[model samples]
Target: MKILIIDDEAKAQSLLKKLIADLSLKVDQLFTANNLLEGIDIIKKEAPKIVFLDIEMPEYSGLEILDHIDLEQYPFKIIFTTAYQQYATEAFKLSAVDYLLKPIDPDELEIAINKALKIIEQNRLSSQIKSLQNALNELKVKKIALEVPHGIIFAEPDEILYFEADGMYTNVILKDQRKRLICKPLKHFVEQLSQNKFFFKPHRSYLINLNYMTEFIKKDGDYILLDNTIHIPISRSRKDDFTALLRETFL
Candidate 1:
């Protein structure tokens, strides 16, 4: 991942760089620009994934970045770094952008980086979906692309037993007992696979393929047993509806 820091103050630039290193972020290239123009040049040339832009600059303030570049055309994540508190309101007006106060907190910086990574991953996932659709049309088979840090994996929807939510990522459990970690939330997969009749959300964090369900146990608490023998809870609110649907479909 490429990161560009656009701040005139040398100290601020160094501090941010140090903090990023300390946090152990996966930044492949870290570029520093003393002004917004230089930053824009680097952005056009290098195309950094995340940019730490300072709102207060020598000539062109970071806010002017909106005027300089067509953000809609080149969608890179930006996190505004400024000492002044007043600019926070304006910075948030831009969608999915984060604003951090100067003398940045390590925790906040880490959080902002995570948010940026998620958004970048989402963009990649979107592209992969488009590619998947085209490939499916040509191949005449149903498949989805799972994004990992290394590359993409194409898998059949029926091969996926379930999806488990893990913090900012999701764990995809396959029918063969292989578990693959993807850099996207479970909600994304739920929405992407909503049209498929086999997958159902049994709980907030789980989307299970009904074909893999072996048993629905309701002894002490409601839960489900899958083909791979993993027991996952069924949400109380969804219990009645889920049971009714299971009966209607299977029994």
Candidate 2:
């Protein structure tokens, strides 16, 4: 398993290398590139399985490196590292394996590496990269690719009715009332579905697509009734905002 770190700051690169070394990840070879051009060259030649990319760079943004590389030819998992939260949503839009906030936490680094390894093992790199490219170009991404235990499940946003939180996993309910349990949490879906105006998180445990919203029941904590006869609660704090949004969009 080859790992590459692409960051301009020597200190940031050194710290990341040290952290990876200390954690004893299954890295056969570790590579580093200071800028996007060098990183592009190394990526073309070496083809590392995982890349710890710095979102912000001096010459060009790390995301620009994707423009130069043929991801279908040399697929790799990206784990974006950034000092700002503003880029977190954009990073997720890229379908990155994970985004870590710097100065990096060892536990988070380990988790990100483990996720990348899983993705590499599944060989879904090409599909994820395609999704990322679509998002980067601001294209209408109709399908959502979800990684399940067996394989990847590609679903249309409209096919989804709502999401229910179940401990570490989320239960995805479709328009047909069929449910699929995924390893990702509800928050992950919230971020992924943010671009679609129909998906809204009215409560901590649920993410409902307004397209399927049949009724807003005001009794017993203000829950929403969906086409599938499923009821999702709206948090007290978010009820007013959610109702206002519903009125503005539907009424």
lDDT of each: 0.89, 0.87
Candidate 1 segments exceeding 4 Å error: 137-251
CA shift at 43, candidate 2, in angstroms?
Answer: 0.6
**lDDT of model 2 at residue 226?**
86
Q: What lDDT score goes with residue 197 in model 2?
A: 84
Per-residue lDDT for 1-251 in model 2, tens only?
Answer: 88899999999999999999998677789999998888888888988999999989987997676678877888899999989888988888777999999999999999999998898877767768888988875544578776678987988888988888999899988888888989898888888878778899999999988998888888877888888477888888998889789788988
Report the C-alpha displacement of residue 193, candidate 1, in angstroms: 27
True-structure Cα RMSD, model 2? 17.7
Tell me, by TM-score, which candidate is best.
1
Please give the TM-score that candidate 1 achieves against the real structure. 0.54
